[model samples]
Target: MRALPLSSGSVLIDLHTSWNSANEIPISTTLAYFSSSFRQTRRGRKGIASSSTPLSSSSSFHSNSSSIRKPSDRFSNGSLVSSSTPLLSLSTSRELELFLELVPLRMRNELLKHDELRTLIEVVIDLGRKPIARFPTGDWVISDETVKLEDLHHAISKVGEFSDDNRSGIDHSLHRISAIRNRKMQIIGLTCRFGRAISGNAEMIRDLVEGGGSILVIGRPGVGKTTLIREMARMLADDHLRRVVIVDTSNEIGGDGDIPHSGIGRARRMQVPNVNLQHNVMIEAVENHMPETIIIDEIGTELEALAASTIAQRGVQLVGTAHGMTIDNIIKNPSLQILVGGIESVTLGDEEARKRKVQKTILERKGPPAFTCAIEMISKTEYRVHHRLDATVDAILAGKLPRFEVRRVEEKANDSVTTIVEPEKHSLHESEVTEKEYNTTQIEPTEDFIEYPVRRMIKRSNTKPSSTRTLPVCVYTYKILEADLLQVAEVMGLENDLNVTDDIGTADVILASSSELKQNRWIRSVAKFHKLSIFVIKVI
Candidate 1:
C-alpha cells in the first residue's frame, strides 16, 4: 500500500506485486471488491471478515497511499472506530445516556414517564439549567454546566404528567427502554440456568437459534408461549450477541417506560407502541438499523404476518410468538397461515391412512385443512420441531410424520447409570367392536361358593382298604386372559392357589400369572363357554 494526495479524488496501488506497468484500478472497484470479498469470507468463517489477499512473490517493494484532505484535515488522523466490541468497558450510566440520546423524540415522552420535579425548585432554575447525557467517541458523560437536580426533575415530571393519560402505552415504552438498558449492560446473560429456560416449547427456540432456521411459537391462551419467547430473546441478546429487536404489539416484550423487564442480550432493541407500521419497522431495522436479528411478540393480525414475511424475505433472522397448538390451530388463525403460508394438507393411501388418528380432541372436533409439519416432544419441558419430512402429502397421510426423542441419563453412586425412557409412539386409530359380541349375562355365585375349588382328603388312619375303586386321577390346567388373571390374582396373596380345583369342574388346579395370561388369550373364551372357574395370579 502506497499513499497519494489529490484535490478531488485519488487512487493508489501497492506496487509490491512486481509488475510496474499495471494501470491504476478505480478506487470504487477496489472498495467494492473488498466489500464483496469480505462478505464471502465472513460467511465462510462464522461472520468474521478477514482479508485473504495473496502477497506478491516479487522482490521489489513499492506502495502508494492517498488522501483527499481539506484545510481543516490538518488535525485528522483518519482513524476509524471499530464496532466489533460495542459494550467493551462501557459503563451502565454511559449506556443509559446513549440510549436516551438515540431514542426518537415522539416516543421520548412515553419513555421518561416516571421522574418529576417538585414545585419548590421551579423558581430558581435558569433556562439553560437542564441535564443531558452525551457521548463523544462512544464515551458517555454528563454536561459540564452546573444544574439543579430540580431542573432535571422538572423535565422528567413534564413527561410523567403527559403520560398519565395513556398510562398503559407509556408503561410499555418504558419496558422497551429498560430492555435496551440491560442489553447494553449485559445483565440477563449474567443470570439463568442452561436447559431450564423454557417449557412445552423449548425445541422451537433451540431450532431457531441453533438450527440455522426461523421459528414461530404458537399456542392457545395462557400457555405462556410469549414468556418463553422473551426468555429466548434474553438468551440471544445476552449470550449470542445477535442483534434482536422486539416489535412488541401488546407492550409485553418491553416493560413499563421503555425498559425490558427481562434482559435479552441484544445490541439494539426498539419498541413501537400500538404500531401499525410493522413492515416499515422491519424494513427500517434492516436498511438503516443494521440488525442481524429481530424478534416480534404476538404477531396476531394478518397485516403483521404479511409484514413479517416481507422482513423474512430480506434475509434477516426472525423469532416470534403466536397463539395456537396444532398446525390447524395456526391456519384457522387466518393471519398466521397467510403470513407463513398455511400448513399443507397431507394425502395418503387407503392402507396407510387407515392407521392414522387425531391426537387432540379440539382438533378432532373442529379440524381444519391438513398442514405439512412434524410434531415431537421429549418431556413436558419442550415440544419437538415439525417440518415437511417427505415430498408429498401422502407421506404424511401415511402417518409418516417424523418423531424424535431426547435421551437423558442419570448417574448414581459408583457411576451406576440409569436411562430415563422417553417413548415416541405414532398416532393410530383404535378399532371398535360391535355390540353383538358383548356378553350381557352375569352368573351369581352362591354363598360360600369358591372361585377355585379343591378338596383336601384327610385320612383318619392310614388305611387304604374298603371297596376302593381304582380310577385314573387326571390333572388339567388352563390358561387365563389378562382380565381374568388380574381378577383371580386379587383374591390370592403371597402365593399361587393351586389347591382349589375340585369345584372348578376339574380334578387338577392351576393358577396362571399375568405373563402366562397374555400368552393365553383364549382362556376367557374357553372359561366362558365351558363354565369352568379359573383363578389366575398376576406377576409384577
Candidate 2:
C-alpha cells in the first residue's frame, strides 16, 4: 500500500495476499482485499448513490466488500458520522462453509438455492421434523425428508462439546449449536444459529462504550444482542486501545477452541466450564486478567447480577446482555432486578410525604444501580437508549415516564454509517407529543405527578426567535431578592420565558423558601385560590 496526495481522495494500491503472523486478526487477509478493492472502486466515481433495491446481502454471501468490515471512523455522541471504509459481517467464507457442514447433505443444497443466503439467521433440526432454514424475512423448508437421529449426531460430532448450558460452537467460528435433550437426556433437537460478528452494528453506542460506564443491554431473543456486543468488544480493544476481556459462558463470544476467534479483535476471552459458575469466571476475568472492560452474555440469575454489580464497583466497564424486551422487564424481574437499582418500599415521614405529594408508603429505588446506562435493542438497526439508568429507574419507580432516545442506524451510499438519535420517544407509535413539544428546548414547568417529558435533562438550548410568543410564566418570589431571581433566569437562559412580578394574583407559580411559606398563610391561600404551584427552596 502507498499513500496519495491530499488533493486526490483515493490512495494508490499495490495489493498482495498476506496474513498477519501474530494472529492479531483472523481475517487480516480479507481486510486487505476489502480495503484495496473499495478504494480502487471509488477512484473515479462522482458520488455514491442508493438504488431502490437494497442489494445488501441480496446476491451472495460475500455480496460486496461492505460485508468485509473494518474499524469505522471516529465519531462523537449527539451527532451523525460516516465512514469511507465499509463495515464487516462474517469475514471469512469458511464460517458459512463450516456451519453448512453441520446440516445433512440433502438440506445443505436446498439452503444454497435461496438468493439471500447471507440473511440466514438459523436452522432448526428436530427429530421427526423437516429441517427448517430461517431468514429475517421468513422461514424455508430445506427438505421434505424428516430429520433423524443420524442427522443430529452428525451435527454434534462436528462442533465442540456441549457444555452444561447445552450450547456448543464450531472451533474458530462464531456459529453456535444448541441441543434439545429428551427425557432420557438424549439429543432430540438442535438449533444451529450462525453468528456474524458485524463490527459496525455497535458503532451507534460507541460513545457509551468509551464512556467507561457499565451498560446492561436487554432485548427479546434474536434481536442481535450477542452479535452487537461481540463487535463492541473488538472496537474497545482494537480502536480505543483498551484491555477488554470476554467472559464467554456458551463459547459464543470467542468461538469454540483454545484459540479464540479473531472477531473480537485483540480482546482476550475466558471460557466458563459450566453455566452455573459463570459469575466466578466473571470475577476471575476482572481479578486475574486485569482488564479495563469485561463483556458477558445472558446475564440471568441473582448471582450473575450480583457479579455484574461487583465488577462495576471495582471500576470495570461491563457490556452484558440479558433476557428482556425493555429495561422495564429487567426492573420487574425478581432475579435480574438488582442489575437496575432494585426497588424497595419506603415509608415516608408525614412532612416528607406531603413534600413529594405521594402516599406515606411507596416504592423507591433501593440503592445505586450497578449499570449506569441501559439500552433496549428495538431491532437490528434501532436502539432505545436510557442515558442515565438511575434517573430512568427512579422515574419508573415514581410512576413517572422515563426519558429515552430512539436511535436509528442508517448506512449511507457514501460508505458512511449514520446514527440518528430521536428525542423522547421509545417508538414512532409511542410518541404522543406534538411537533412543538418535540422540538422545545426548555423544560415546560410542571407540578408533581404531572406527565412531563425528561428530554430537557439531556439536551437544553436556546430557542430561535419565532413570530408567535406565549404568555410568560409570572413568578411571585417570597423572601428572596428580585434581582437574584432575574439573575438565575439569565443564567439558565430562560429570561425570555420568565416574568418576575410582585403581584400574587397574576402569578402562575410561587417561588418561596420553606420558612416564608409556613409563616405566610395569606400567600398560600392566594396560590390555592389561583391554582398556582409552589416551588419551595430549603431554608439556610
Candidate 3:
C-alpha cells in the first residue's frame, strides 16, 4: 500500500495488487489497521472510519480528530498540551456535511472520504457537467458523475428560496448558496460557499477597537473583511460591554436567519430589507435604536458614506468595512470620496505661491473625514493601520507618503501573538508646527519696494519699536521654482535679506515642492536631524 499526504493532516492509502497478493490481507483488516494508525498519530483523537472497495470503484474513508482532551490524561500521557491551546478550532466539517447530503449518494460517499473537505471553500454545479469542489490551495473534480436537472433541483429544495439577489443560505449557518437562472427564471447553476466563524482574527487591532474611535477597514474581496468586522462587533459588545448594533445587509455579518449567530456576541443586528436601502437602515439604527456604536459591512454608496459621517458627527463611534484596498482607493472613488474627506482643487495667488515656491493650482482636503482611522488588510493575518486618517490624507494630498504602522499576527501551536512595526525613520516628515514657525519669521520691507501710503501709515502709527533685532534668513530651494521665491521676496520688500541658496547645510530654512518632497523623503530626514525648518508647498 502507498501512503499520500493530504493538506488536512490526513493520509490517503492506495491498495496495490502486490500488497494485496503478497500479504493476502483482508480488505476489512487493512482498513482497521489504517484507521488505528491515524488515531495514534493525531493528538486529541476523535473518530476514525474507513471503507474498502475495489480501487477502480473510487471508494474512500475519513477520520475526524477532536481537539479536546482531559487535562490529567494530556499531561500524564507525556503529550505536549497546554491550558492556552485553542479548544474549539474553526472547521467547515458541518457545512460540508450539509452540502454533501444534497448530492447523489454514490458521489457523496466518494467525496466525503477525501481529506480536502475540511478546507472546502465552494462547490460548483451545472447542468450536464461534473461537480467541482474548490479549496484554498486548488480545485478538483469531486466525482465522475455528471450533474442533471434533478440534482440541481434537489440542491435548491434543500436550501432556502433564492432571494432577489439570487442568493440564499442554510438556516443558522454562515454557508451561502447562490443561483444562476435562465431567461425563464429557472435555476441552471449553483455555487455553494462555506463560511466559518473564526476567532482571534481581530487581535491585531484590539487596542484600536478598545480606544473607541471611528474606524474604516478596506480590503479586496475574500480577504476576510466581513469576518474581521463580525469579530470586532463581538469583542466590543461582549468584552467591553458597549451597546453595538450591526447594520447587516445581505445577512452576511450576523448570518442568515431571524436569530443572529453567536459569533457576534451581544451585539443586536438590524437587517436591511433591500441592498439599496442599506443607507436608510444605517440611519434607522442610529435614530431608533440609540446604539453607542454602529457596525456596518460594505459601505459602498454615496448615501451610506453621508450616513457614516452623520453618525460620527453625533459622537457615536463607528466600526465598519468598505470596498477598497487602501486609502488611495477611497480618495480616487468619486462616490466614496466623502468618507475620507473629499478632494478639491484651489488656485493660489502669485504672492502666496512664491511664499511656498510651488505651482498656482493644488489639491486640498475639503472637510473633516467621517472615519478617524483607516486599516488596510494586506492579508488575513497582516494589516497596515493609519491611526490618524486626517493627517494621513493631508500628507498623501501634499504628495508625501503618509506614516503608518504595520501590524501582523503570528499563530503558534499554543497561542497567537500580535506585533506592531513602525515605519522607517527616513519616511517621517516634519510636523506642521515646524512649517508654521518658518511662516512666522518677520521681514521688514525695503524703502524701494514699500508703497508710499504704507510707509506713511507705518510712520504715523507711533508704535514702540521692539528691542529684538531681525536676522537675515538663508533659504535653500529644492525642486522649488527659484523665480517664485525671488518674486515673493521682491513683493515682500526683503529681497536683500531673503537669500535663496543651493546648499542645505548653510541655510536656515529648506523649501521644496510637495511633489518633490514625497518622492525624495531622504531630504526631510536630513532636515529633521539638523533641526532645520522645512516647508512643503503643494503643486498643480
Candidate 4:
C-alpha cells in the first residue's frame, strides 16, 4: 500500500495489488495491512481528503477519473445516505480499519466495503460463531464466515498481551481488544472496540478546566470521558503550560505503550503496574513528580478516592473521571463517595432542626469535597455542570433539586458551536426551609443572632458591649491528646473557659490533630458548616 498527499490536504491510499485479489493476498500482509490501514485512515480524515483512490495499475494511480470521493464531505449538509441510514459525519473510523485487519481476509474485505464503517462501534468474534459488526445506531451485520481459533490467535498475536482486566490495546493506538475466556482461561471470544482520540471534546467544559480548580467528570461508559480528559491534558500542558501528570492505569488515556501518545501533548504520564495498585500510583505522582495538576481516570475504589482527596488537599489541581452518571450517584456509592466528600448523618439540635424545618437526623456532606466542581456528561454533546460542588450537594441533601447549567456543542454551518443554557433564577424556589420557620419561634429578650462572630472576635475587647460578652468556648479534639489540650488551656489561664467536648454539635471550636484530620474528613466538614473555630495541632 502507498499513501500520496493531495492538494486538498487529504491523502490517497492505494492498496497493494494483492489486496485487490483474495487469491494473491499473502499472510505477511496481515501486520502490514493493519499498520498501513490506520496510518492512511487517520491521514484521510485529519488531512480532510475528499476522496481515496485505489490504484490497481501504475497508469491508473495517476488517473483522476479512477478516484472515489470519501463521501463524508458530501453528507456534511446533514443529508441521509438512505431513508433509514443517517450519515455519521462527526464519527471517526480510523480504528475500524485496524479492527477489520484482524478478521479473516475474505470477511474483512466485505466488512470494510460497508458504507457505515464510520458508525461501527465494535466487532464480536467468537469460536464457531459468525463474526458480527456492531454500530452505534443499533445496526448489526453478520459475516458469512465463522470465526475459528486460528483467526483469534492471529488477532491476539498482533496486539499486546491481555492484562489482568482481560483487556489489550494496540500500541500507539486507542483501539482496545478485550478477551472473553472460557473456564480453562483459553480465549473464546474477542470484543474489538474502537477508541477515538477526539479533539475539542473538552470545549464544553474548557472554562472549568482552565479555572484551576479540581474538576471531577462523571458519565456512563462510552460517553467520551477519557477522550475529553485526553484533550484537557493536552490543552493544559500545551496551551496553558501547566505541569500536568496523568495516572494512566490501563494505558487508556495515553495509549498502550511505554511512550505516551502525542494526543496528551507535553503532559507526563505515570503508568500503573497493576489495576489494583492505581491508588498508590496516584499518590506517587504527587510526591515524586511535583506536578501542578494530576489527571486520573476511573477512580472507582475507596483508596483511590482517598488518594484523590489527599492530592487535592496538597494544593495540586485534580482532573479525574469516575464511574457514575451524576454527582448523586457517586455520593450514594460508599467506596467512591470520598471523591465528593463522603456523605454522613448529622444529628441536628432541636433548635437547629426547627429552624431548618427538617428531621433531627439528616444526611449532610462529610467534608469539603475533594473536587470543587462536577460535570455530568448527559451525552457526548451535552453536559450538566454543577459549578459549585458544595452548594449543589447541600441542596440535593435538603430534598431540593439543585440547579445546573446545561452546556451543549452543536455543529452550525460546519463550525462547532458551544451554547450554555443557564437555569432561570426565578425557577429556583426557596430551599425547603424559609423565613417563616424562624419567625414562628419566639426570640429571648436578651438574645440576638450575632452574625459574623469571627469578625467581631477580631475587634478590641473594650469596643465590645459588656452584655454581649463572649461565652465559654467548647472544643472537640481529634487525635490531639486531651490531657495536653487541658494543660495548654490551663497554662493560658483559659482551662475553665476552653472545655473540650466529644459532641460536634455542641462544640464552639474543633482542635484537630493534623495527621488524624487527614483521615477523618467528615469531622473537619462538620466543624466548617457549624462555623466553629478550627485549630490544626501538629505533633512532632
Q: Pick the candidate with the highest TM-score.
A: 2
**In candidate 4, what are the lDDT values of residues 400-508, reduced to their tens digit?**
4566777777666665554544433323333232333212222111111222332232232125234544656677877777897677667655655667788766776
Clashes of 2: 3
Q: After superposition, how far is residue 182 of candidate 3 from its true place, in Å?
A: 3.5
Cα lDDT tens digits, model 2, 107-150, are 76667667676679999999999999999899988899999989
Clashing pairs in 4: none
Clashes of each: 51, 3, 0, 0
Candidates' lDDT values, in order?
A: 0.38, 0.70, 0.69, 0.68
Identify the runs in model 3 with alpha carbons over 4 angstroms from their true place. Answer: 1-48, 51-96, 99-107, 128-130, 144-146, 413-540
Q: What TM-score, over all chains together, does every model reach?
A: 0.35, 0.65, 0.63, 0.63
By TM-score, the better pick of 2 and 4 is 2
Best by lDDT: 2
Q: Which stretches of model 2 miss by more than 4 angstroms?
A: 1-90, 412-540
Worst 10 residues of 1 by lDDT: 187-196
Per-residue lDDT of 422 in model 2: 47
1-540, model 3: which lDDT tens digit per residue?
Answer: 555565656554543222642232335565565664444445654332332221111111121223222323322212222222222331233334445555555555566566766667778888888998888778889878788898887778767767777888766567778899999999999988777777777777888999998999999987889889989999999999999999988787787888787778889999887888889999999999999999988889899999998999999999888888889899999899999888887788999867754456667788889988999998887788888888778766664456677777655656545444433323333433233232221111111211123334224223432355244567788876789778766776666656787866578767766566656555554565445756655433
lDDT of 3: 0.69
Regions more than 4 Å wrong, model 1: 1-208, 343-380, 387-540
lDDT of 1 at 412: 58
